[model samples]
Target: MNKLWGFIVAYFLRWFPHGLEPGLRRIGNPGPESPVLVSGNFSLTLKRLIRSLVGQDLWLLVANSRGINVWCAAVGGMFTHHNVIAAIKTSGLADQVRHREVILPQLCAAGMDVKAIREEAGFQVRFGPVRAEDLPAYLAQGKKKTDAMSRFRFDLRHRLDMLLSNNTMFYLIVAIPLAIFWPHRLLAFTLLFWAAAFYLYLLFPYLPGKTGWSRSLYSALAVVLAIPAADFFRAGQPFLHYGWMIAVVLVFSTVGFDAAGILAAMPSDAEAFLHRLGIKRLGSLLQEKTLGRVALDREKCRGDMICYSICPVGVFGELDPDKKITLPWQNACFACGACVKQCPHDALSLQPRP
Candidate 1:
């Protein structure tokens, strides 16, 4: 029953950032020589990490990230060098561990500065595998990450997981107002919204568009067309039929805009695309472009390949032994700042695009 309740809440009320207490936690009765791993204070993430490390003897340092997952918190600037240092200092981890190394989740590389952490807290940060499930194998392999473990894949499972986790909050917030104000159309709207969501997620890769916004908009249009087609088949009054159709289109289009924000690799561009669609009344969908082009200072680069392994998107090219890091496709950069933050020599920076 507890598990059932957690599942429902995770799917429905996940927007609320439920966080755990920030401190050092001993997993499986670890001693001073045990490996130390650090993560954000998101409740679900903590639970998953605990489950993954059930039999392992290690130290877990939980940093305050306002209850957001590592990747989102890192990208949103909630998880950073300061948070890591705070966790280390507050937890008294320096006195507990003999080794100076701490394992951080690979996703946190976007915002976490290894140099800053080493300077402030006296700990060397080593990035772990992308997923917690791979931690056992990662440890067994002497903490060596395979290429597949480092790379981020947005496959069907990942897309569906993201869809369910994100839509849970959307449903709770939108469902109440919809039932209270437009009770007559509540069921229709709810069903249409979910149907459009599934279509967009399931057909994400094959959807006809260059950008996430375009693909979601196309999917929303496909679902919205059914309303008019149904009206035509029933030979309903034109005024009533078109009015209902307009309402449905407006609601679905708004949802499409929301989906664009969640599913798009570059959310700022998605917002711009929605603006082009004449959507001006979006309450929270307006994300301004704060990060510009990711720049590499070749003279400072040491060719460490840390950025190459950490980037979720293939933004950085393969590192040649003789050449510095090259930006072959800067347009594909998501501006997560992982490469910039993890660069050992501080060779990478984000410059405002001209």
Candidate 2:
């Protein structure tokens, strides 16, 4: 019951930070020679790491990331060299480990400064695979990551997972108040909400483009078609059909806007809209971070290859092939600003596109 309840909270209220104490934990019979790994204090992330790397003899260092998962925390500037430094120094990890190196999650490459962590914490940072499940293979191969391990995935399972886990809370919140006041339309609202969200999610990959316009257009199209379909099924109930049409539109308005925050690598339309309205983000994913362009100065490119290794998307290509940084898959840039943050040579810059 407790584990099930934990999953319910982790899945539903994940929008809020669920922090664990920042400290060191031993997995199995970890010794001084065992590998030391690091992650944020987000409870779910740690649980997954423990579950994935179970039976491994290692030390896990939990850093203070304001309870955010590694990718989000690192990109948002909460998880960094500073947090790792604190975790290492305060956790007394040095005495417990024989080596001077620690493995961080690869997704944190967006903000974690490898050099800084090395200099300050006296620990070399080797970024691990993108997913926790890949950790065993990563460790098995002497911590060498393959191309498959570096690139993040956005398949149907991940897309639907985000739909079910992240945004379901928003729907519940919206529905409850309406359920209290307009109790008669509760069922209609529920049906419309799921229908709109589900249809969009099912066809998310086939959506026209990676822009807010495509989503908004498809959302309107879905609601528009839904009225006719509902009417066709109930030819005599014209009044009921119109009522549902209105309900569908109302529910879909929030759904499309809400989708701006989902798993697609596209920039958040909701954030951009809020930014235009003179509202600022609460120090999370800044709208400018996504709206701005990331430019690389080849002259400043010392061929350090941090950008090549750090990009969650396969935006940067392998350095060995060109002996220089390349953006072969540039359009796939999620604009998380990870490479820009960790660029030792200051070669990459992010600015609003003119």
- Please name the candidate that would achieve the greatest lDDT relative to the true structure: 2
> Which residue runs of candidate 1 sit more than 4 Å off their true CA positions?
1-9, 233-240, 258-261, 264-289, 351-354
The Cα local distance difference test for each model comes to 0.75, 0.76
lDDT of 1 by residue, 36-100 (tens): 99999887878988999989999999999877788877776778989999999988998998989
Q: Clashing residue pairs, candidate 2?
A: 110-338
Question: What is the Å distance of residue 239 in model 2 from its true position?
Answer: 8.3
User: In candidate 2, what are the lDDT values of residues 1-354, reduced to their tens digit?
Assistant: 966766776676667667778899998899998888898888787888899988788898989988778887776667888999989999999989889999998888777878888888899988888889998888888889888888787777777776666657768898899889988877877876787778777676677656754665666666678667777687854355665656666666666664645656666777677767877554333333355656778878888887777777777876645466877766556568888877888998876655
Top model number, TM-score: 2
RMSD of 1: 3.8
